[model samples]
Target: MAHNALPRPSSLPGIEDLRRGYTPSTHEARQSIEERSKQLRLEQERIDAELDRHIAEMQRLSLRRRDVVRELDLNHALLAPVHRLFPELLSEVFIHAVQDPFNVQKTDFAVRVLCGVCTTWRAAARATPLLWTFIDLSYITSLEDPLLRLQLQLSGQLPLTVTAKVQDQAMQLLLVAFFDGMSDEDASRVVEITVEDDGVVLSQLRSRHLATLRVADVNIWDTCTQGELGFLTSAPTLHKLTIGVQYECEDDDAALAFPVPVIPDLPCLTHLILAIENEFPVSAFLPAISQLAPVLRVLKMSSFEVSAWEETKPTVTCEMHVLHSLELQHYTHRFLTFITAPALHAVTLIGDDAQLGKEDPTESLLDLLTRSRPPLRSFALHDPMQGSASALSGCIDLMEGLQRLNIEDNERGVTSSPRLAAVLQRLVCDENTPPMLPELRSLSVQCRGDKSPCVHSDVAAPLSQVRLSRKDPRVCAGRAVAALE
Candidate 1:
């Protein structure tokens, strides 16, 4: 009964048996790992340095590539036709780029965009006075904005068309300052101006420089202490003037007479339009119109408040000799009796719902026409009330010179088609009472309620007969009916 035993291992072994027999204690293996980790970290550091060198080289090459592209672009630009164009040609192009100088809301985009292109372009655009002449001060953010001064200086001796809208008190003061600071020479350069503000801006520009003024949407009577509208009387050169005022008073007692002292004689004022939105005493505004009658070529008054006025016998008859066009809207018959236009060629009368059945202006209108004996050619009556149609028909009876007649009854809430039809049917050639407006060639009829062809047929039949009896085929253009309805 004998047993066999195995041999014990040694701490170290020869290279031949090392791979199979060698094994380290726990501490010895940890120490060996530490040494290997340190060597690997050092090797990683070396590799990182090489990577840094490559990255730096790539960055340097990228900068050099950009420089080369920039130079190529510059060379290409030099050869371009636009770059070779003379400054004069560039100035002409800049002038052509400006769009809609009359639009008060638009900014000066043309000059700004052209000047921003390059230093050379900026000099060329700035030197062109025509480009800066249409300076819109509406978009100016502050008084300190250099745009106003720059534009004024760049414009040099050329005339300017200035348009601005003031939204606040600060802007109004700024506008006043802009005009107040303008030298006499610079102020004289302002030929045309359109301002929409609270009347202060215009009062500052009372220098005798402005020629044409269109003051729109101005709040006057309520804002001004004296309710003065004589803002333009100082402009001796003013030829064309348009004034629109809004009365924001809550009650009639709050209403004040506009232009308290009354508008002075504008000796040179030829074209005048005064549009009042709310009710004002005719006595207050009529004097202004009467004063301008002598020199006025065209007169238009629109949107007056309806009120009864005491009629006093006028000592002197105001006559307008050069007046070619007269248009009155929302006014009473008594108001028309004030002034007479002898040379009137065109008359447009419009009455609203408020003017319905208030007063008969036809007698005065007929009397005025008889007295003036104007060569009235065009007449338009829009939205006339009930009794107004028959009374105005008398106008046709008196006016044998009328060439064009337009009758529109849609907005007045009343229809006078039947009465108008009767008047048209009565048009006949007779020795005692000749056909009304024998020279009438064009007739325009418009009705909103019943625009059916049958409604206008009664009037159309006689118009065709008149044209036929006269043996004038050229009386109308395309159709026997002047308008569809």
Candidate 2:
């Protein structure tokens, strides 16, 4: 390689006369200089011609080398073990390349790429129905009929997962492609469905054996008035349901425009999450959720108003015996007063003072605790009432199994500043207190900055006493709230 890179000895001529600055002083010297210059020019031209010929030869060889290398690669690929595998085995490899069918997006379409690779791969991909089972129609909102038709045809008899974003303006196209495209048998094969859009309805949900349905960031307008959403009432196999609605319209009009909801018994549902952006009546969901109480293990509701549920009240107060976790935000205590959960252990209440104080909410919550008598283990209250000391004491008295307690941003009145201090002081000092919340393990309190300074010293005094007399409580305090004490 090194020898080939260097210029040939005859190709380079040394300019010794020029370097020595040999001036032509006489006629003979001038003729000798001209003859030498001419010889050098002739040699240079010959070298240039030789270089051009070598470059042309190198180009020809390089093309031949590339062709040989390509042929070798092709032969090696043909001999690979993967090529010998059965078409079914190759189809499995294609499925693995896709990773997860449910979460696939239009941009990273693995099935389509696999089909376009070669004739054999295309045949394998086309023959495998599972590879095309999950169809993401989110990007093709204009209802590109060919793609939908291809997906449906390829999916065959396998269970399908469908995801789409049906915009309000594109409802007709979505309906024509998704709703009208499928026969009852084809729709029944659908196992999961997700829709993210504004004021759009999917009537086919009623006919399908869907197990998971998530309709996120929706604006339910006049479209649901056709009773298309009644599928949620009788979806016997549906296990997980998540619905998020943006409420920016008149409440009564929106309620009336919505299809009259009919929530029947759901025996298989384990997870239910309902989130409304604005204040829709929490009572509106009672008809549906009451039926779910028997089987639900986790229930979360966020951002809703509370009003009377229906004119014909339920005669029996449904008990949620299986419900273990409950999370609520921007909700009133009226909901607690309505239902009872005996097996409830974890509870999180996130709200402001007004919502807690609405309709004398503390008493309602206390009554709920008294009635349900849950083996309460974990409790959290966000921005609770000013008089939380008494409420905390009462809760501890009722729930002897309580282990974790979390409170946040308690800054309402003069008494509120020392609420934590007072609760601890009574628990440690009072002879008759009997070690309130004896099993307490973790206590977290976050107070307003202005109040913590004055309250810190008061709370600190009981730290040593509580530790000496009883087991140490894991105390976490912030915004100047005293630790341990």
Name the best candidate (by TM-score).
1
Reference-based lDDT, each prediction = 0.63, 0.63
Q: How many clashing residue pairs appear in each of the predictions shown?
A: 0, 0
Best by lDDT: 1
Q: Where is model 1 more than 4 Å wrong at Cα?
A: 1-103, 111-127, 141-144, 199-221, 226-233, 248-261, 304-316, 332-334, 353-364, 412-416, 427-433, 449-458, 466-485
Cα lDDT of model 2 overall? Answer: 0.63
lDDT of 1 by residue, 211-323 (tens): 44423223343343332344455567667777666645344534433442245556777877777665554455666677777788887777664743344546677777888
- Deviation in angstroms for 329 in model 1? 1.0
lDDT of 1 at 29: 82
lDDT of 2 by residue, 292-357 (tens): 787888888776543333223346666889989887775544466667888989887776554444
Query: Could you list the CA RMSD of all candidates, in the order they appear?
Result: 16.8, 11.4
TM-score of 1: 0.67
